[model samples]
Target chain A: AQSVTQPDIHITVSEGASLELRCNYSYGATPYLFWYVQSPGQGLQLLLKYFSGDTLVQGIKGFEAEFKRSQSSFNLRKPSVHWSDAAEYFCAVHLTGATNKLIFGTGTLLAVQP
Target chain B: DVKVTQSSRYLVKRTGEKVFLECVQDMDHENMFWYRQDPGLGLRLIYFSYDVKMKEKGDIPEGYSVSREKKERFSLILESASTNQTSMYLCASSQDSSYNSPLHFGNGTRLTVT
Candidate 1:
């Protein structure tokens, strides 16, 4: 079975500091990876996605993720964390078969500290 | 911009009561999905519909049913509302089953079954 794992349950980072959220996935074929962020009482928004071309993909709100096939990892990173960046981050893998199903990880909650 | 609208922002129900959660997408998307978001579970898919009057079970479909009578409307039904069914339900839509089309989610409905 395909699965996604986000090791960190909660992380606290000082405002303006660099942030990195780890994500790992288990799948047989070339995985279609995606990162999504959910704010308080709001729906999830797509941060970035990794298809085929580039190893490093840029996304909305000054976020980027690098897909490392060997590591089975797609880690999300931001140069400087803002107070508004505090949210729950989820990593998902698209299952390419008869359906468009996605396997999601246990999200990591980020708390931005001033 | 695609807009996925959930009919309710919050709901409370009694056990064994039948419950209905509504979702509507303005983009006329072909794929609509229902997922439950928990504290550490991230999001677990409950049901999905690829087209009108078509529905499929997802990872966690127990105690849940779906109806997609129209292109823009998808409804999730809880046959017997239980305390364990209290969760944040999210509705999402995508253009197709392609890798390029990402899901657009609604501001979830927080359902609490007493």
Candidate 2:
């Protein structure tokens, strides 16, 4: 079975400041990792995905994440976060095979201050 | 862009009532999934359908059943509404069976059972 853990329950960041959200996973093989963002009263949107090739993957809305095999982590980062970036972020993992079910972590709520 | 649509944005049901949640996707994707989101628990998969009339149980499928009579529509049914089952219901769809494919989600339905 695959599982993901997001340590931080909530994080606050000032606008135009760098932001980082940590995520860790436990899987036997290389996992398909994804970052999703959900605004208040809205559905989740895919921010980015990491499969195999690149360790550093860029995503929409000026977000990026690094897939670290040694740490079993895929942490999301943004150089300068905007006020609109305040949302709940989730890290998900999928097995490296035909199964498409995704196991998600306890989301981290991000609050941006101007 | 893929568009997944859930029928309701909010619903209030009484205990022991039969609840129905409907979802539809415009991308004609082969896979559709139903998930429930709670405060400390991210998104727990209730059920998923790989194809029309082919439904599979997910991690929390004990109280939920699903119907996928057509390719683009999937319906989740709750036999008896419970207070504990009150949560945000999310619907998602993926392009294919590939593990790397990302999911497109609907705006979610917040259900309250009283």
Question: Over the stretch B69-102, how does candidate 2's per-residue lDDT look in tens digits?
Answer: 9999999999999999999999999988897678
Off by over 4 Å in 2: none
- Minimum summed lDDT over a 10-residue window in model 1 chain A is located at A95-104
- Which runs of model 1 end up more than 4 angstroms from their true locations? none
Instruction: Give the alpha carbon lDDT tens digit for every residue of B23-107 in model 1.
Output: 9999989999999999989899999999999999998999999999999999999999999999999999999988778999999
- lDDT (C-alpha) at residue A108 in model 2: 99
Docking class of predicted structure 2: high
Total clashes, candidate 1? 0
| Predicted structure 2: clash tally | 0
Measured as a fraction from 0 to 1, the native contacts recovered by model 1 come to: 0.79
Candidate 1's TM-score:
0.99
- Global lDDT of model 1: 0.95
Clashing pairs in 1: none
Per-residue lDDT over A10-91 for candidate 2, one digit per residue giving the tens place of the 0 to 100 score: 9999999999999999999878899999999999999999988979999999999999999999999999999999999999
